[model samples]
Target: MTEMTLDPRQLGTGGLFTAAVPDLASHEAAYGRRPSGWTRSPLLRELEASGLAGRGGAGFPAWRKLAAVGAGRPAVIANGAEGEPLSRKDTALLRQAPHLVLDGLVTAGEAVGASELFLYATAESLPGVGQALAERRDGPRVTLVEAPAAFISGEASAVVNALETGTALPRDKAARIARSGYQGRPTLLHNVETLAHLALVARYGAQWFRSAGTADDPGTRLYSLSGDVPAEWVVEAPGGASLRDVLRLGGAEPSSLAAVLVGGFHGAWVPAEAFDLPLTARGLARYGASPGAGVLLALARGRCGLQASAGIVRYLAESSARQCGPCMFGLPAMATVLERIAAGERAPWLASEAERLAGLVTGRGACHHPDGSARFVRSSLGVFKDEVRAHLAGACTAHHGRV
Candidate 1:
């Protein structure tokens, strides 16, 4: 794989999880620094100053989680569940930067006085994480858990629930996982990317971590670039890099994009005209999207946006845990309407019906599944206005809405 970095601000560092720096020793050499060791107070201070946010779609502050698991010998979980269908960055990080992730885990464990460190990773990704763990000589009492490869199973709460009871369903009411998680112990759970950034911050301090990105949200991110690309590639970029520049790393020029899915299934859509949008939290906030799971799926010029969203809606609906009424039922209904719209619905009312269904589904579920699906459905209807018009007129305008 040709590793291309779009950040352009090296900040006296090298590629994060690139193939050339394949393993632990190489990562150490590439980064050229490591934290001596971490203690709680100073570690929390530095992390707070770094202003790192969770990279697992939710942009929650890293310091908030680290600080919230207050004054206990809690547990730490490195989440590599890769539940989002459009995301592959976690697997790549497991394969290439596993040690850095583990180092961050160790640092976090030390800072929080964690007794056990658990890693939740997919079956395909477990081997990589296992290999990295085997090569490590020192760390906390670490355990390896094989995570189910389901979308919702990767939820932070679900991971803890799976570890505790062997049932991987998110809790109905979401509590602060940091304060109370995994056997009712104060736990520090974070995505693998966030942990990797923690390792950087632990070694380099907050300012060094802030050297590359914007002031409000500083540091780098790994984005899984899929769809309409020569090949799937993970691009490393600063917080606020332009969407156009990031997409180019996957061979997607702005002119080639019909519409881009800015976040994961729960994310919003941005028309090609909005290609100038940045990839940060604030940047995406302007467009009403977050860096959810760091997935940037670019739809090519000839693809039908309706068809793409319809399939995803159906998949998300099927993946639901079936615990929530609005999600389990409402989502399937919305998916049906999206499928109808995708199949060149001649009824002009179908669009309004979709809008109605999406509105009904939003905010009604116990989880964000319904909300995100509604966003995907609603955003597709807006971004693919031309396709919607064509479908109403009984035509697909482009490729008969295939894929």
Candidate 2:
């Protein structure tokens, strides 16, 4: 596994992964103990005022998720299942700053009057998280479960499913996790990073939480920066940070980039021309991208974007839960077409076929798996139009043999 790297200068002061806080004792010493005894209303108000959004993609307001579980003995889950292949931020946080996440989990449980608390994470992160839990002197007991390595396992519904049914597949969309979750209780599922931010918000209040980022997007976010860089680095960036600056922080030269796949395998591509834009949802909207889980995969100048996209799409297609026709049939079909296109298929209708298949699979799954895969495929077709053309003409313009 690639070791996660951090740069304090890029993180600014009081960022999540500080050098001062390595162990549980150091964590409490640096940030002080988490203040206890919060009720629903005040906590929700503070979270709303903080303008914090979910870091686990979808960008939903954190307060809204909490509020949705109103008037119930809800379950709170700290989700550290970093299933995205390019994402290491959650894992890094869980390993290096486990106490902070534990504090958040306990804090959220208190605020919501939770009946039970759970911490779900990747296998590699379990030992550290378990150790951190052992060190806590006065927090609510938290149950820890090892998360499966599948890409879809981290989806909100899927996380609930895994704990309840021992299956990592996503549950039906009709039953929202907040309304009906594990063991038929209202559950407040938050990404581990989101929970960590909640811990800070609980301690420092909304204003302090909002001190770093923009008015619309407050607080700092950990970005998993990789591809054509010196190494995979998990760098903390302020919300709505410039994409170019983030890549530079990861040691990527702006000029050498062909494009970036913002978000993870399910995300869209933004060409090099738009690298200067902010990483916020609003900033990346025009390019059909978002800061989904803060995953930024840079495409070097000589790489074949279509080939790179095809491989990811193929992986996503195979990663499907297969409970829906779109995932079971449509995604594989779409992947096959995309793979053909990447392999320099001269058929004039190949590109259109891929689009047709994307349209077919989109929004027709039991989950958003098909939709996200479609978005990735569609974005590739648009961003790599030149490459598509070259491949159709029996040539690969990127000259790297394969992307």
Candidate 3:
């Protein structure tokens, strides 16, 4: 097993985790009393005006998610299930600021007139969350569910499935989780980081929330940085931050890295030349990368990028829920081909075969598992093309094999 080195750091002043909000009183002191009496329409307007997007991989508008639930009793979930292997921001947030997350869950519940609220997180975070719940006297009752240590468990459908059934595998993708989910009720699920941000938005108002980040991408974001850095850190930075600045915050010099995985295991790769690019969807679109899950993994210059990508692809293939043909067969086949190419297989057909397999699995999974896995593998091939050529010539261009 790979060792998880999770250290939390904040970029500027007054952002997430900068305050010591370990318990309820401290949280209240830092953020003031939770703004109450916010109904659906009003809350939607506030979120929309705030321009807050989900900190989760998708970056969907938070207001739209609440509006989608429509009327009737809804279920709200604070998803702290940080199942991405290289991501630890959610776990750090849950441990350090559980009350804020709980407040956000309650805020969302109030907005949707939700009948049930759940805070689902990994075991490492449950104790703090449970304590936060115990500390709270006002607000709707929140049930605590332990999240399993599986990659796909953090997917929205899988989260609902985990609550309905013991297994944390994703169900049908066609079904709209917002309309019918978790015991066939309307469910609004937001990542823990997003909810924490929402909690801040609720208190600070839209303009105040928009004050930090760029006009296009508003508010702050929590990023989990690792891979060839001096240390693993969960850092908070303004939205649309430059990758170079983020690396510097994580104790890594951008010049020393060959490339950086902008997202997590299921994310895309960006060459170091583009390190100056903003960590936003539009900014990274050309590179086939985004701030997905707010994960930035630095690949040091002398490390074998292909070898590192191959290992991650293999892990993703093995982590699949295996509920659909793409996950059950296509991912493993893709992984095998990628591994062969990374292992100095001289065959020219290897790269094309990998591409073919990726196409076969794209958009065919029950969840985004197969698609994300394919994305990672395809990005590896594109970003490490030079390495691929060297390997095809039965040689390696990396100064060292470490990644």
User: How far out, in Å, is residue 290 in model 2?
Assistant: 0.8
lDDT of 3 at 95: 74
Off by over 4 Å in 3: 1-21, 400-403
lDDT of 2 by residue, 112-168 (tens): 889899999999999988888878756678999889999998998899988987788
Q: What range of 10 consecutive residues in model 1 has the weakest lDDT sum?
A: 8-17
Flag clash pairs in model 2: none
Count the clashes in each prediction: 2, 0, 0
Consecutive 10-residue window with the lowest summed lDDT within model 2: 4-13
Can you give the lDDT of residue 49 in candidate 3?
Answer: 95
TM per candidate comes to 0.92, 0.95, 0.95
Candidate 3: tens digits of C-alpha lDDT, residues 57-174: 8889999999899566789998988899788888878877788788889999988989999999999989878888888866679999999999988999999999999789898889
Choose 1 or 2, whichever is better by TM-score.
2
The global C-alpha lDDT for each of the candidates, from Candidate 1 onward, is 0.80, 0.84, 0.84
What is the lDDT for 4 in model 3?
25
Question: What is the C-alpha local distance difference test score of candidate 2?
Answer: 0.84
* C-alpha RMSD of candidate 2: 2.2
Candidate 1 clash figure, as a count: 2
Q: Which pairs in model 1 have colliding backbones?
A: 57-292, 57-293
